[model samples]
Target: MDKILINVLKEVQDNDGYISEKAMKNISVKYNVPLAKLYGVATFYAMFKIEKQGEHIIEICGSPSCMLNNGQKIEDFLEKELKIEVGKTTKNKKFSLYKTSCIGCCDEAPAMLMDGKPYTNLTIEKIKKILKKY
Candidate 1:
């Protein structure tokens, strides 16, 4: 990992998963790294979540192409099955549901990314399997 990212992780970990903007600015100044560069790195990786995440982050693609392929249905299923709404974590905080735009995997419409792993052609059964792995 990059030194800056490691430090950022440490800071976030120390603060219960949130990295304040003030802290980010401090990191930039202390490390002599550009703010824009740090921001870019933070935004570039789906894994680097700027906000707090639960133990598992479930990201469902909701682009037009995906929507046409029952993406909404999948989202609904997830909500109903997991008993949580998008942007909300589960009661146990083991999982968080997030609806994203395009994941650039339209060929696998109605797909979801679970903790950075892409699971395509999602079905309730498939989702169960994925959840089991977590």
Candidate 2:
């Protein structure tokens, strides 16, 4: 059941970019899993987004290596440029900002994932250019 739940949730997220409350209820009824339990499971995993997301997901690494390499500064730059804070989606739904513990790019330190593509050794200028492309 756990494996099934994981697959079901993944399918929902892949299709909608998030798990809506209506979807959760449907899953709960179909799988005979309690709604509260489903919510708890979804909220417990960082990979699960229960709310609506934007067209693009921007995930920045905030691990020790990334922080040492000015990841915070990059996050600040994005917040200012996008006019949205972390964990928030752009008003136009074009982008969503997130800070992740790591993105397996510690070798690159200040690395980021844009729409699942990796960008390493970021600078404010580079961020600006990247944003332009999105």
Candidate 3:
């Protein structure tokens, strides 16, 4: 039941982009789960975001391998460009920056996932161009 609960929370996040208080109440009533228990589950997992996200989700690889290959520089550049610290959504809700561990692109090192699409071998110039598209 615990595992299934996680799956259901994931479904809500997928469809709604984030878990809302109203949705949590609906889940609690529909699943016979306590609202507190549901909130605990939602907050326990980093993958479960309660607050709404920006239009573009940028997850930069923060693995050691990536860091050794200019990942930190890329992360810094992104923060500067976006003018918001990691884990924060921009004021306009256009972009959200986050640091995530290995995305299995060590060989490609210094990579990022923009809206779930892998963008590898990044450079300041490349990122600038990429951001322009969004």
Q: Any runs in candidate 1 off by more than 4 Å, and if so which?
A: 1-16, 19-52
Q: What is the lDDT of residue 7 in candidate 3?
A: 92
Across residues 26-129, which tens digit of lDDT does each residue of candidate 3 receive?
A: 99999999999999999989899888899999999999989999999999999999999998999999999989999999999899999999999999999999
TM-score-wise, the better of 2 and 3 is 2
Q: Could you tell me how far off, in angstroms, the CA of residue 58 lies in candidate 1 after the best superposition?
A: 0.4
How well is each residue in 1-134 modelled by candidate 2, as lDDT tens digits? 87789889999998988999999999999999999989988988889999899989999998999999999999999999999999999999999999888888899879999999999999999999999998
How many clashing pairs does model 3 include? 0
- lDDT, model 3, position 130: 99
Error of 3 at 7 (Å): 2.5
lDDT of 1 by residue, 1-134 (tens): 36657667566646766555676687788878787887777666654556666788899998888889989998998899889998778888799999888888899888888988888988778888888888
Candidate 3 deviant stretches above 4 angstroms:
none
Query: Residue 44: error of model 2 in Å?
Result: 1.1
- lDDT, residue 69, model 3: 95
Candidate 1's error at 7, in angstroms?
12
Please tell me which predicted candidate would have the highest lDDT against the true structure. 3
Number of the predicted model whose TM-score against the real structure is largest: 2
Q: Backbone clashes in each candidate structure, one number apiece? A: 0, 0, 0
Clashes of 1: 0
